[model samples]
Structure formats: structure tokens, C-alpha cells
Target: MNHTLAWRLVSGVKINHLCTPRIAIPSKAVTGSQQVREFSTSYKRSTVMPAWVIDKYGSNEVLRLNNNTEFPIIHYPNEVIVKINATSLNPIDVNMRNGYGSASLNMSRDPLNVKTTGCEFPLVLGRDLSGVVMECGLNVRYFKPGDQVWGAVPPWKQGTLAEFVVASGNEISMKPKSLSHTEAASLPYVTLTAWAALVNSCRLNKQKCPGKRILIIGASGGVGTAAIQLLKAWGGHVTAVCSEDAFSLIKDIGADEVIDYKAEKLEEQLKSKQPFDVILDNVGGTTEKLALQFLKPWSGATYVTLVTPFLYNNDRLGIADGMMRTGVTLSSKVVKHLCKGVHYRWGFFSPSGQSLDEIGLLVENGQIRPVIDEIFPFSEVPKAFSKVEKGHARGKTVIRVTESSK
Candidate 1:
């Protein structure tokens, strides 16, 4: 199995968990009127969760399935253990498989860089997950055992690829009731990217959002689809760029204008539209450069891209030179774009339970909907990662982690 074993998060998860034990099943978390016993770590973690892990980074060839993988545990206050129901795949997971961030992985070993460190082998990798909370730390307040939740974990830690993963309370929220675990698992990573790019970087929050015009490139992918829905929720005019086949789904999600990337010259379409307040780009390099023509100049229009740190150089040049060169190259681009009154920044996903709560509200109110491309059984994870690596998925690809029905 690989990236798509129905995947899922860590920190103020408000969850981390291990193998499942058959216990008295409660439909929901223990609340005010319900009488339930709290979980203790000493309780048998007799079950071993299976996981797909890598001892050393490489391509898909390095992944090994270990059915006896130790169940995850919680040693920190504010932590909760989660039994992952499903997870999804993204480009980052594929890159990590090929050792794309080996330098950062090595550097994280320094004690001073605690925030940047990832787990040591046998390391599991999956960014986001939706699951049930099995146990809550002694100091944890917001959630309790039996709570259904979802969140994204930092890439530097052991991932949600196993039967369980630990997360802090601040990193997760109760999963939206409208979404099944498979549907909820498709969120997190891409939705967080959309939030970072649009809300955090472009300043499209509630107060400043009416009537703003935004353009989303690669609008058919997961991030693009999420960006479109979020932009609509903020009352912005959305123009989506995708293939003709994707137009229906894009339009259904509330895009004001949908441009077929294949049928039209994108630059020509932008020129006709005049200017946009923000351009949230999923494709980078040349496509990103060309799209600069449409920014609403003098208004300090922002251009945010989900691609950054330009890994191509890392592969061509060695690590140190590649890093130095990336810094110089990025600085040049930032300066050039800044002078034209456009702010350019890279988008990175940061998990926030607060943000998840807001998104859940949106989901409950029917403001946004999850877009799933395909679902692979847990055992077929390598095929799922390959699909993401090929970069042709229509929306998000999900994995079914357990054989049981939701």
C-alpha cells in the first residue's frame, strides 16, 4: 500500500491512535448526558496496525507493508489518538517518496529544529485523514474518546498512513456530519492550501471579500476545485481554468466564468477580462509567468502559487547549491513581481482546528462540497500515488483504509 490508503493529521488534533480493539461501541463521543469511562494508556494496545512505510526515501519501490507496525501512542498533553478511516494523496507525498526533501529531513535531526523534524524510520507518509478518536490525553479539553474527527499533520512527523496516527487538539475538528470518512479524507491538504493562498495570502476573508475578482489556474484539480468553492463562499467572482470535460463540475461549484484551458488561449482570455484582484495558481513556472498579465495592477493584486522551493534545481544541482540557487531565483521573482504592484508568495498548508471549524460551517450550510476523483482500496496505494504523480486526476483521489463500511 502507498499514499492513498484512505489517508489523514496530527497536533492539537484535538488525535493520534493505534490498532483497534473490540470494545463497547458508542455511536458518538461521550457528552454531558452520557456516562462513559475515560481511556487509559495502560489499556491493552494488543492490536497491531498495518502500515506502508519506508526505511529510506526512494521511489515507490521502497515502500513495505508491515502488518505488525506498532500502534501510535500519545505522550503529550493536548493530544488524542485517531483510528484513521480514510486518507487521500497529493503531489507532496509522491515527491517525498523520491527523497525530494532529504535535506530538511536530515536537518530536522538537530534538536534546535524541533518544529522542522520528521519521524525516523520506519516512517509512514500521508498528510491528511478523517477518523474516530480512540483516546484523549489527560490535559485535552475540547474532544473526548469516540469523537469523529479530521485534520492534517505536518510532513515532518509519522503520517496518517497507518491504522492510527497521533495529533494534537489544535490541529483537528469534528468531521462535517454531511461527509463520509472517504469524502472528508479528500479535504485537509488541498483545502488548507486553498485557505493559505486565498484567505491568508490574498486577503479574501469575510470582511474584505465582496465582489473581488479572482482567477484560479488548473481549476480541475483538488486545490483548484477547493479554491473555487472557497472564493465563491467569500463572495468573489471566480474564473476557473480547466479542460472542457471539467467545465460542468467547475460550473456546478459556482464559478462565475469557466475557461477551457485547451479551447482558448489563456492569455487572450485574461486580456479580454481586463484585471483580477487575485490569481491563485496551482501550475507554476511558465504558466504562472504568463498569467501575470491579468493582475489588477496598482491595487497591489496578489499572485499566490501552491508550487514553491522549485525542486527541479535540487535534482540537477546538488542540495546546498540547489537551495542557494532556489533562494536567489525566488527573490528575483518576488522583486520583479513586487515592482509591478503584485505581491507574490508561495502557499504552504498549515492546519488549524479553528479553520476546520469554519469550513465545517460552510459545509453544513451547503456553501462547499468535496470533490473526489477515485477511491482505491487500502492495499492498492501504490497505484493511487502513481495516479497523483502522473498529475491527471480530475479532483482528489481517496483510499479506503478499512474493509468495514462507514
Candidate 2:
């Protein structure tokens, strides 16, 4: 009887044609079981993936594509693995490639100095990503396998220039249904930085933004362009300062007025539009002092700049001394500006999925659109880097990681 049953199972004969087996298994059951096993096996077998990494920071030539980069795994329950479909370059990425913030970043990575020096080698260096969740940890409640999402990877974390990246649940949100992966990838890092400045630092919002005059210095770049659209969406009057070549692009994104930063008597042009409620300075150096002169004194007006020397100081000095110097500098500047009857702030990027959720709504409603200056295939990442390094982008430079990013 056992021999007959085994033969029937192996030969695919009907159960009735042979003696009954001790345990019955249907054809559908067999297929379902195999499918489950295959799924688990495939997920486990992806132990390594492809990525762009730098063993030592330098110029673009330092970037090397490795096919066997270790696949990131969720070390914490709140972490999720995203399969990157698209990513975009930011100025920070370029700076990081040249070892801009290594000192501070390394300290954050291993606070106790337990790791040896140069442990941050083979660092991946892209900040923004739009992709699908391949796996979620047990503690992740909002996302599951196959959910499309977009987020800015914090500079301290491993970046998105890889096939797979691990991000905390709080760092990402649902991707806007209206945007392709490539388009969505362009906004996160820039938009989040703008949000940190406008909403968090300056306390401007949809309710408060109406009729407020906001000045954006160096307004043709990624953060500047993103700021313009965010302010416009909230009903703010935007004055963008960029080169004459970027005027049309600036205006197209809803800047109410445009000023050429290179024009003769640039201060005169800015003075004519004095008493701006908020000033966002993307250009550092003398512009900070010059732009502050235009803010409305004693009216809760604020000047927020993204060009602070926090990272550079940390990179030059050790973390403790660097932070001390930064604190002293920032405090002195604040006091100096406070006496002038205006608020002064240094804006830094803060990753918030909730903020992305709000921006996603704006994107879906057509209140904001991505300003993509150029798109490059994954193979041409070096060319893309060179394009950004040239320093005259009208908007964000995007990289299409997957052919199906659209």
C-alpha cells in the first residue's frame, strides 16, 4: 500500500487509482507551499547588492561602482529596506564626496571613538531617494512590502545610491501618486531643508504665509527653487535673487519678483523691496550681512541661512571644539541681529516623514511641481556629478536608478 501511494504521488496519478496515503496533499496545496518557500528563499538570497561607494573621499574619480556591496539589513525594528528606483544629487553630495563633513559624521557614527580611524570608507553618498519598500521590520506599522515611498536620507546614515537602503520609519512617507519616481526623488532633500528653514526656523506656514514678503538669495539652486514653490503655495510673495539666466525659471515657479544677483547696484534693487518678512540666504559670505539689511525690523521678521559653517568647522576642528566655536559664533550673530530688531537663524536639514506627507499633498493637488534641470541614467553618475559641480543649475539634477523609474 505504501509503495502504491508513493508511486501515485510521484507520477501525478489520481488518488483513487492507488491505495490511500496517510496524509493527503492537494495539487493546489503543493503549488502554494512551493511559492511560499521560493519567496522566502529569494529574500534571503539577496545578501549582496550593487552600489556606488568611495573608499576614500576625493573628486568624482574617487567614486567607484561595486557590484557586491553588502545589502543593508534592518538592525532595528523601526527600520525598513527600500529598493531604490530613483535618486537625485544635491550640493551636499558633492561636498561629501570630497570629504567635507568627515570629522563630524564620523563622530556621530561612532560617538565613543570605538571604531578605528577611516572606518567610514566605502561610504555611499546620495541623499534623496524614491522607491518601494521590499521588507519592513516587525515594529513598522505604517508600511509593508510593495509600498512606494520617498524620503531624504540623513547625511549620517548610509545613503540611497545603492540598490537597497535602510531607513527609519520616521524618515519616509508615502510617495505622491502624482509623481514618477524620478520626479519625486528631486524634491525631498531640498524641500525638507526649505521646510526646516521656513516652517521650523522662521515659523511661517500656510496660515501665516499669506501676504508675507519672502526674499530668497541664490534662488536658482535646489533649495532655493524648492523654497520658492513652498512659499508660493502658502500664498507668500516671493522675491528671488539669481542670475539673469535663471529669471524665467524662477518666475515660472511663482516668484513674484526676481533680482539678478550680478546686476550693478544689487543692494539698491533689494532695498527697493525692503522690509521683507523673511529672508532665506542660500549664498553664504557677504550676502548674509547684505540680506539682513532688508528684513523688517521689530516685526517678527527673520533671516534664515542654510550656508552656516557648522560642518566645515567640525571637519576642521574636533567635534567638541568645533561645536563650542559654532555655538559661540551662532550666539554672537543672534545677539547682533536681535539688537537690530530682527530674528536670525541658521537652518539645517531635518528629516520628517510628516513634513513629506504634507508636501505630497501639495504635489498631488498641483500646488507644487518638481523643477528638474537634467536627468541622467545610472551609468552616467560621474557626468551628473560633474554637471552639478559646474554650479549653475536652474534646478535639481536627477539620477534615474532603474529603467522603470517613470
Candidate 3:
């Protein structure tokens, strides 16, 4: 009888077969026996979904949304999958589309590849996203599925211009309760830049910020707008340089002083205001040199340049690293500090979920608000990118990718 049963089991009839090395096939007389086959339910795998994608580095014409179908799938233990609600455009995106930066446009390639294939074309472009958490990786502890979140994606990973995006657990924070998806979508990159510049680089604490005179060059831009609010909220007096058209907008956002750079020479205007303690110079050109003139002695002012000045030689100006070690000796007299009171610095934004969360709280409490200049549908993403490239937008340009209510 046992031989007959074993023969039937190994004959591949119905569901009868080896269960595994540890578990044996049951006989028909088993208590839970049924007419159908039985399989192990203990080790079921997780499911994955698709995303829109791009493959090559080129213009907007090169973007093909049919790829990245499985984009939000977790490839790393610290990843969290999000259903992108909306994404905003940035100048970096344009550079990325043009294959200007390190991001890929198509097939993934190793950095060591002899050819340019390492960049991988058909890459996703949008960096900042407002979305809902659809899934979380096993190691993700700060967030769970169904949470409303928004923040920047890791620089080299798949971006947020698709239906789904995967971000490191530390790359996102909870969405501000006061902001709609459209409003929150405009913030991440720009606000993070402002935060890093003001808090991390400048090290302006709220107590120390009171009564300090600060000037923001290019005050009407995305980063500038956020800086204006942050500076003012911390009790610093802010002076902004902008075009005539954006003067009122800058003032409305809490700028105590405004300069229309297009209408007048920057130095002539600032000479009337004397030296500033901090100059957050965003524009490069004559404006940069003018900002350097307004720094108070012993007061450190930072000039964050978008355009690197290759023509200006720091070595020739006696501003190199070696110059600092040997204190300036004039006529055998030691000069501890220079009279032209200002410090120069270059800054870039780094991704951080904790910083994003703090900024979100400020936004929720009305301490700051994202300046949203335009909202475009996902299908119109190309047009949005063009708008950002024009460099005239007063605030941020966003792309609505998914239904926010969902």
C-alpha cells in the first residue's frame, strides 16, 4: 500500500510531488486533505509596479515616457516607494536633459565604461517630488505606506518625473499640512538650498540673527524667495536685489529692502546703506564684485555664486589657502584682519530628510511658504522645462504627475 501511494505521489499526478527536503507530501487520509493542490503560503514575495521613463540624453524631444515601468520597485533596503503627486522643474533638470550633468538618459553603464554608456540614457529628470508613500523597504523605519510626503530624490537615482519614484528613507519628510500638493511640490530643492546656505554654511542662529543686516542677490528666484522668509523669520533684516517687475513680490515676501538691479548700479545703491553683515549673493557678474565691497570688517558675508568666475584669480588676489597661514605683514606690522569686512563662500544643497521635515514644520506653521509661479500637467513637462530654462520665473514651476487626492 505504501509503495503504491509513493508511486502515485512521484508520478506527477495532480499536486502530488516532493514538498521540500524537510516537508513530505501528505497521504490522502490526512485530516486537511482536499481535492485541489496545496502550496506554501509562508514565503510569499512582494509585488512591484511600473514607472514612466526616459532613455537618452538630449532635449525635451528625447524624453520617452514609456520606460521605467518598474521604477518604484525597491532595489535597496533603505528605499521607499512613492506615488508621485507632482514634481517641479529646476534649471538642473534642463542640464540633465541635455546630458550636461552626470545623470543618465538611457541604458545604465558602469562609471568605468570606456564609452559614455555609463551615464545610461532614458533617465528620469525631475528631482523634487510631492507624493504619497505607497511602499517602504524593510529597513525603512521613519515612514510607512499611505503617508503624505515630499522632498528631493537622490541625485543619481531614478528621478520623480514618473508615476512612481523610489527615494532613500532619509531623502523625504512629511508634507506640510497647510500646503496643497501643488504648493508643497515647489519646495524641496530650492528650500533645501536656502536652508543649507543660511543654516549650515552661514551658521546664523536665531538669537544671533536679530538686528543683522543681510542682503540677498537675485531675490526673486526660488532659492532667494525661501531665503527671504527664513532670514526675516530669524530676525535678520533683508535687502533683496531683483528686477523692477519683481520688487513688489519680494517685498510682499518679507524683504525689508529691495533694489532693482536693472534700473540702477548695485554699488551706488548699497553705498547709501553702508556695509552689510551678510550678503547672500546669488547673481554673478558686476553684482558679485559690488557685494564684496559691502562686507563689514570682522563681519563675514557669503556670496553664493551660480556662475563660477574663472576670470577672477584667487591666487593673484592673495586669497588662496596659503595666504591664510602667513598673516598679512604690512611694513613689519601684523594685520590680524582685513578692513574689507566680508567672507566669500560657495554652497550646494545636500539631501536630508531631517532638514526637510524641519522646513515642512516651518511651512505648516506659516513661517515660510513656497513661491509657486506655475503648475503644469505632466504631459506638458517639456514646456515647463523650457519655462525654467528662461530663468525669469518669479518662483517655482511644478508638474502635476498624479492625482493628489489619491
The numbered model that scores best in lDDT is: 2
How would the candidate models be sorted by TM-score, starting from the highest? 2, 1, 3
Question: Each model's TM-score?
Answer: 0.85, 0.89, 0.77
Which wins on lDDT, candidate 2 or candidate 3?
2
lDDT string, candidate 1, 1-406, tens digits: 1111110122234232332323223448956654322333423443468998988878888888888888776767788888899999888888888888756655544536454334477888898889998777767778877889989887777888788888988889999999999989998888888997888888779678778889899999989988888878988899998889998999999999988877778787777785888998888868888988788888978898888765656656756788889899879988998898888877778888889899889888889888999999889888888889888568899888977526
Q: Which TM-score value belongs to model 2?
A: 0.89
Q: Global CA lDDT of candidate 2, please?
A: 0.86
Q: Summarize candidate 2's per-residue lDDT along 168-190 as a digit string, tens digits.
A: 89999999998999999999999
Q: Put down candidate 3 lDDT per residue, 122-207, tens digits, no spaces.
A: 56778898889765655677787778999997556778888777798899999988888788889998888888777776778677
Q: Model 2, 5: alpha-carbon shift in Å?
A: 25
What TM-score does candidate 1 reach?
A: 0.85
lDDT winner between 1 and 3, please give it.
Answer: 1
lDDT of 3: 0.70
Top TM-score prediction, candidate number = 2
After TM-score superposition, the amount by which residue 80's alpha carbon in candidate 2 deviates from its true location, in angstroms, is 0.5
